[model samples]
Target: MPKTALLTDLQRLVRAYGVLAGTCDHERAIVGPISREWIASEVEQSVLLSSLPAELFDTQRGKDLLAAELYSDRNVDPRSIDPDTLDLSELCRDRVINSNRIPKLEPQINCAVLVANMLLGVRLYGNHGAGVPEISHDLIVAAMLQDALEKPYVFSALSSAEYEIVDADYIKTWFGPNVAMLSYQIRDALLAFETSSDSVVSSARIANSLAAIFASRLRLTARAAGDSVVSFLGTVRRAEVVKKGLDPDSSFPERPYLARDFELAEAALQLAGVDHYALREPVENTLMIAVKDALEDETKRSRLSGRRGKAVHELHINLPVMEYYVASESSNSLETVHLASFEMMRSLEKGRRKSLSTMVAHAFRISAFAERVLGDALEPLVITLAMLHDVVEDGSAAVTGFDHSLQKIMFRFGAPIAAMVSELTDSSVKTAGAHKARMTYEQPHLISPEDQYNVNRFTELDLRPSDGRQPYTLSGIVIKLLDTVVSLEEGIRDPELMTDWWRHSGARIFWADNMRGSIVHPLIERLVIELKQSRSDPEYALKPHRVNRGRLRAGRALLETTLNHLDMYTTQNLAILSDEYQLDESQREFLIRSFNDPNITEERFSKLVLDELLTEDRLCRAMDLGRVPAKNYVTLYKKSSVPEESSDKTTLLSYRGNALRRKAIRTELGLDTPEGITALSLRHEQVLSMYDQKMSSTELKLPCDTVEMVS
Candidate 1:
């Protein structure tokens, strides 16, 4: 057979050996305390033995000799065995038969035996050095026995007097000084790789460690970032080692090798391919490339290649050289987040209005917050949902294409994930309203009808049940709150977007209310403070004075109507004021005074209510009253605390109130002259000119009024 065909067959055998070993380990754990005879019988009946090629074994006499040597004693002394005289197939059979005899030492024993077999096979067919400058009988024996020599206690723990500690002296006596020295080097390299805090290490140590870990996880489970390091370790030549005069016991030189061993190891993974995205840490693109190269299916290989190319384009990353850089930069661990990020970039890449970088940052922030809140309970699910919350809504139709995209997601991922994405996606007003209704149902006393109307648009789902029951899962609601918090944070960072942010402030209130008793309440409280700071900034206030004034006027009208409808201010109404409205004692007192004052003008009373009494929290509370039953019974009366005041005192109070009202109006009209009259006049003229230009540029039809002339 060709060397390539031989190596391919060896890779297949090694993978089968790994899976068989892993199955034995699992069975030992579950079945409990079986005898070594049973383990040997189980190995004899397994497919691993049946699949061994006849060419690997010697003649029948050689097999009889090997069987007699192995079956003579349960524990074979290492020093008595000669590597040159042993047949490869017989040795593999002996290892497989005795692999699970020691329950506590099974994994390590299996790992060592499999790795040694892999190295020997790669050396024979792939023409690669195992780890040393050349392949030899002693090298093969040392690779197989390295783990036993390193951990002598495990071998001693076998049946009484069955095995002894296989130490360095025993190895040297059996395989000579060169194999003993090589085994020591392998052990030291493994220790350095596993124990060293420094990430940068010699390529030889990395290769050895990768082989060891890969052998250990033969079940093809997900690997961590540190363990998934797949780099090319070129073959070490005897001439190069001799020319360098390198110490045999020290670290190997930093240089490229033939990489035949790495190729063999990758081929061993062809059956159960690596899930590059399913790993818990961000894996390098080399890992993905390695998996792709190992795959025999052309379609799978091309599909993976195409997706990577698309990701490279969408992320605007230069491929080939910078793929590892991009992979290292990603903090997301879940495969869904990675896909969602790519989809988001693809959808938003055309307009580039919203920064893709910012969106990525938001996704990370939301996922992190969700992970923290959900903890280990629903961490994976919550983070996946949170990261994908905006993909369908914000995605461009031409790119993601709505239903087609969702169907693809469903097919690629599972149905539960696609369903959650659907729940999170606000694809239509009806869906948005359903989300609003769900949130409103969580806390009926906290959300306003206007917010419900604005969010839902229809009156059908507006009514909150009298029982205040929430019927939805917590994951969707938690993601909504987290998404809102991240958005509000973005708005807070950029002052220009604050105006647009406040337009959705009602939704924020609703979110906070719904999350009142949940784990995300603290986040809501923090966001509330941030919102106040942004709202109260004098600069922000000045930027949108007209819009602010209009909102204030509308609020004042609602407050007056609410006050007029109150028949009596019962204790229940007071409780509602304190709990739902969140009004302080002083604001409530002032509101009562302003409502009952017969002498105060309606306009002045409304101004007092707007400026002194009704804060945003109180306004949200007042908005909720239209749905609450307590609002229909509340009444206003003159406070007994208001004593008869002298005319001079009353006049002084009147003057102060008038001045305060005048200043409020000036601030609302942007006439306080912060930058002096000249700049203000220039700004006013610029605004009027822009308005006139806009009006004259567009043709408008005006209504003509005809009046009969009296003359």
Candidate 2:
């Protein structure tokens, strides 16, 4: 799918009108990426009296057909209506003549398409089992027209009397009463749909299905700025995840809460002029299961490749609707990433680095971090890089093999992604023996667990930064920084555990040192220098914009919070697990003596002895007490009125209310706590009061003392 195909004439026309009238950004996100084929097909088969073309709007016959389509009742004078009133000349003139408040045209187009398609989808597919109403094509045409007609009224460009002259009733008098009525209904529905939080699953499913069909029809490739096509696609994907009973939240990058499947489905159904119960269970069941299966199994679709003799899978916007059926597994964008990720997993299996699952997690987190900072526009590329970042180095891919991977990436995705991934692989990690080879097993030790701990803590390993390094491209730097952040986040979880886990390499250097040993060392150094300079150097500082600063700050905060929670959890686990086993005095003495002997150290010993000592009785008793993070801190608690107040007259009334208020205290902590919030409030109170008496000694006749109060 090429990017150009998604931008159709219908989209342009709709957007132009939307810009002139002004539509909300969220509404635009929903309204963009409508399928021209689907709309035309619906218009062709609709209960419409005629399918008027752009040119036909100029003819009397065209006006008659349009007027007929608009009004089912058909009580109107068509001859009195001038089709010229439907023309966009005034809107264009306004854009040309005016200097302020002009909306970006492309975004408007995308918004218009989304809204128009969604409206039609709701009308057609959102059946309440009363069967779809005799929906008129006027709804489709009126989508764009209504926005234009309402523009003057919306922007206050026309006065009340002037608006009345071209109001619904007036226009209907010239056009037709039915047309006017239908237009009002559509306009109202649009508003209701945008604002309402009601659930209507059938309508959402249908709307998503319609958008999927449109995406497939247009083969939408490139992301359009200010359009919700990318996000809409993501929403559909999330819906699929929900339909499959998967958690929609991304743990790697962390996402704010999203609505559940039932909620989303219900919302869609409501917007589509249908009730939830009206939807057939059989249809819903099939949509949930079979449609997804069909989407996953289908594999015949093809897409354009940047290289000759190489075609990739077409972008799949999977919908279970008969019209949306694509018989290719690779038809959708989700499938493409899934396939790539699967391949990456398999590659890691051959030469596993930090376990296949952990590596995959890293990839997901990296991609997620990228998406957070860069926005959705670069998500696909960023994710692809994350997936393949370690393949070449960790998988021990040959030069020729890497070249092939690069070629495959270029042909399948694009060059930009291939370039980024190429830069992500730290080739130095593979060439030098900074880290142990995958095949080389660690030497078994005769040390006791305590001795092993001592060795892990005291032994200094020869870890050094790679001297051979080069500069980094901006794209490469972005990915590496994200990679470093994610890696550190994981490594920070019990730094001791990490050191123990990689004990073979000694505890002196861990992730940071390991990174320094790789090709990314110089890049990290450069980044550090830049960051330090950025604090004081105006030229080196981040772009002077809230958006840029906010993204960086927010991303950092989220990463830190997540990292802290994970670290706390792991530390608790370690504390409990460590107490599970203990050596008796005599056994400990013998083991320590044996471990001290260099000859005995050469003999392999088993840590299994300690594991066996941790019987169920001991483990169960330890667990009975529970393990929780320490929470010995003070926090102010407030009450409107304490039933039993302390024996003190320091209480104060709340400013706005007459209710008595006082500070209280509470303390508690829990393990496995998923979520919560704590509030902090500040107050000032007098610590002490004093009374002082002053006497002027110089005044001979005055033995008077003056009293003063201090607060």
Candidate 3:
């Protein structure tokens, strides 16, 4: 929604203070002060809640709804879920339908959408996070209050129809994350100021000024929040203020207001989503109330005494909000620009250097969209990259105490997120150059190669096999490759820089050329200027660092492709495994011969053993009968004595009836062999023999589900 619309409504709401403002007419017998009692009563009253109009309850994919809660279901008595202690899994597995948060209408409609997913039964609907649901009331409520977003019928942007089910995309469009979650900091600052006793020197006046600053920025940050709860609630007060300003008497205006905010806390609680609602309230609500109190205090302060004299003075009080405002108001005012001289160096187009930051910022949309399309697999990395690409260092602020080196910043502040950032940074880093450059002559300097580091007291660079957490798994390695590839693609659009870049940086020229195009793009231009530099300077310090990145990329891609082609399992073994499914003699021989292959990966060996885990197949029978093959039943670890056989029949395992089968399994599988025996080497026949002996001895045995050996 437009800030203008919110302002328009809030202006009208200025009359909320009419009685206090002394603007109301006393001649007409009008009511007096608005009491806290009125607000209190309405707090519990059957406040009319707005729901996504009936027409938009979701027919297509990705629509969200507050579903019917668990405790509300009567058929599932309290006793059913808890046989002994409490729920074994999702207690309300079969029950749940998404609806609005209004309990009075039909408490049954409240269903929690799992935090990670919003699709049909994608989650185990029952309580998974909060203690296993033993009782009905245990079901969590995912209080997403503003499911219904009201828009003017005339607004052409309103899709499908007015009051339709909010599309997931629209949910983000309306109430999405604004400014890398900047409000969180403003919120923290607000909360700190609000709770602090005015018994000290810090003025509530300062807090109030800060609040206006935050509110104004919040308004800008939330510009994209369409029909979103945040958009509605954030704008609500302003809207009411506007309405009061327009007419000090007209009953509360309805234009785009969030009626359910009081009950559902707007949509902030939905951050955890539906899977767990009621449980999250106390924590989320605490945060909400704190921020609310801060907002109220600031609003009051602004009303009493407002408007500061200077920009720097305004910034002096609220650093975070003030900084955002200043940077926004004028480009010259930005104080936190990262020094990424590499993006501009060696490129002929000194002109593009000046606009490089802005262009790159725009370019992020490409990576963002790509990751969005990739969905769960890549989104987190993309979000992390977006934050780092611009925030950490593009070349303005020097990292000292307040501004550590970009590498250190990425490693320290982005500790939890460094892995992801490192994947996308495109550092190229061939032969480790000097990465640090102090501010010189007040000019930003891009660190260059050949500068020797103080290696004696340095953080040693190493990735030996013993290094834990190295990218060892297939997925881990793949992530590394993809991160670099995408970054290379991001810089490939311009070609002229690729040519001129080769001459300037010398060996570093590879950086620009690699970033220019696909594995093959013939560069023809020699001196096209790179974006982001002054025209007179002609050459920037760095050329997008794109070439060495290309070589590294080409190398990694080939490795991935080669790995993909190798056969990890033989056809004969697969055939043997399939035969085990059918049973009898000829099949058993095939299985034995298949195991004779000289080259089978451990993964395949593990798979074969799993397949015969629960069968009565003959080969497994041979292994059980002590027909052990060489290299089979490999030992994993060795221990001491096994527990002595118990005589007590009352014990579940000591019932005595299945003793023979247990003993047979103990022999073939090596009873709790103090020495850990890997199941991987256990041939198909060995697994079957154990199952056969058990089946024959026990009358009350349950049917097996799969052959994978659990023990």
Candidate 4:
């Protein structure tokens, strides 16, 4: 209803009630005592009165009400006001209505008015009155309060016991016994409607049921009271309730202003024969067509089933060549290689549908890396071992116990291949537990490993197999090293997946450290270094040393690329910058100045960029992860605190210098090679320029002649 129309109707009703009572005072329309007495005994001051115009305040009365509450007497039993005292002359008219037949009218009306006003307040503002209006119109307040003078209406989600007390007996004393009885009947009927099997049919069905019940109850109650005005008022109010029950957004009786707007908008759309769904269909169809086109593109295709077929074809094609090499170099028969390859395909076929091809490819790649890098002595053994490496952990071959699976492999591929495969497999890996604990949603870097694991579990790196469980066979270790390199390359190909893998493996902190421990073992390191020393003395220099050195160099390059993308803390503090990262005093000053420069700091960098480039030096020093070295300036600070000054060495500055010298030597060698020198030199020059941009002039000029390539 429009506000003006609603006000007019409300004023007409109040005037009719006033005429019937032989009283027409507008101020008297306020139902209760205006003094402090109407408030509860616990209320020190009436919030309603205080919020009203200041002219309404009486200093003495306000003070008394604040100090000693209006209803301070707790034991007082309220007395009912006589109908005659209200000057309700119409009640005395025998022909008009029977006063004795009427239920408690005054208090019932008062309670209804109070309820309506409270509902209005909740509708206009939120429950906490966060958006209360600056001025409330008198007619609006009066209209809301007058809604209470009719039959009781409730929209309760209360339990039966409490409903009985509040809606029945307690209300009986205030609104009179007859009104209370009527309220009980209404409450029971509504509660029954809410729980009935029919009510569960559908929302529209339930709403129809509620509307029928309310309409019938109102009609019966109005007839019983013998008042057309009462029936009229009941119809209006009950319609509001039924309207609300039909649709929450459309039925906002509390927010009448917004409710009118919603009604008008819906009506306008209805008249125009337009709907939101109709408007959205064309846009939705267009978007779906675009998506279909994008997905249908051949270049974007990635079918796991297709890849599985390709893997099978590639495995068959590569087998004859592998068999030839095995027959020529090793004592192992060609039949053994065939049996192992067959077993590998068979083992991977029953694995996870998506990962089957990937695993087969991994086996092929690992074997190839061993051949290209580790030489003929280890080649056949590593190939056979790598093919069956994951079988005991992932294949149906693994359904049997670990030792039983190894025995099966030994019977098929012989004890040597079986032993190396056993070493490659991680026996302690709890597949079910790890899968269940995996974080499948959100970016992994946002969650710390500490949130996902206990201290013992946190130290474990799933990517690098646990070192404690090994006989450290040379072939097995070399295969595993090649495995790490392949895995790192695959991970770096997709940065997001790489981050998730690091987080899932709990290797963000210990990635390089764990690889150093597993791939570059003491025996391997000593052999490689000694072999390099005796390269000119061919009598002592073993071919395996050159292979091991190549493997070490590949591993180092992979680690460097991993470090470039991983979440290693870089400090911005001047002390840490100069001390740990090896920025000289001048470089440190330049960094500090650049950061403070308004052009760089204000215009170029956002909050996210600044946060990305640097971590607090204090936080880096406070880390306590076991076996993970502290690389921040705190270590430098600790050294400075020592009694005597120890010379600083092994900083990032020296590392960059060495890296530049190596790059220069590699570039020079590429130029010296006669295989298309033009293209190679261009590529080499691009790399040299990159190095120059990354290093200081002094570091770039470091004697490249001293850095020799060990053949």
**How many clashes in each candidate?**
7, 27, 82, 1
Q: What is the Å distance of residue 173 in model 3 from its true position?
A: 24
Runs of candidate 3 exceeding 4 Å displacement? 1-287, 294-391, 394-711
TM-score of each: 0.28, 0.29, 0.22, 0.29
Error of 1 at 123 (Å): 24
lDDT of each: 0.34, 0.31, 0.24, 0.31
Candidate 2, 264-353: lDDT as tens digits: 333443344332332323223323233223223322111121111011111111111212211122322432343344345434321212
Ranking by lDDT: 1, 2, 4, 3
Scanning candidate 1 in windows of ten residues, the lowest lDDT window is 702-711
- Residues 239-302 of candidate 4 have per-residue lDDT tens digits of 4334434222231122232222223322222222111222112212322222222234422111
Q: After superposition, how far is residue 369 of candidate 2 from its true place, in Å?
A: 2.8
lDDT per residue for candidate 3 within 205-283, as digits (tens), equals 2222232322222221111111122112212222433444322223322212212221223232232222232223322
Candidate 3 vs. true structure, TM-score: 0.22
lDDT of 1 by residue, 1-711 (tens): 111222222222222222222222222211123332222222211122212334212322123323433645555433344545755555555332211110111222234433443333333323221223343444444454444553323112212234344467755543456656766766665465445423333443234334533433321211111111111111222222344442222221211111222333343222222222211011233343433343333222212211233112212232111222222122223323333444443332211111111233455456544433332233345555654566655452322222235554444444445555665555434334344444544441223222222322222232221112332333454565666544434322221111111212222232222322132333232223323444576665554212244333332322222121121211112223333344665665555455444567766865676445543445346547632122212112111212232111232233234334433434444445656446534533433333234323322211111111110
Winner of 1 and 3 under TM-score? 1
Q: Which window of ten consecutive residues has the lowest lDDT sum in model 4? A: 37-46
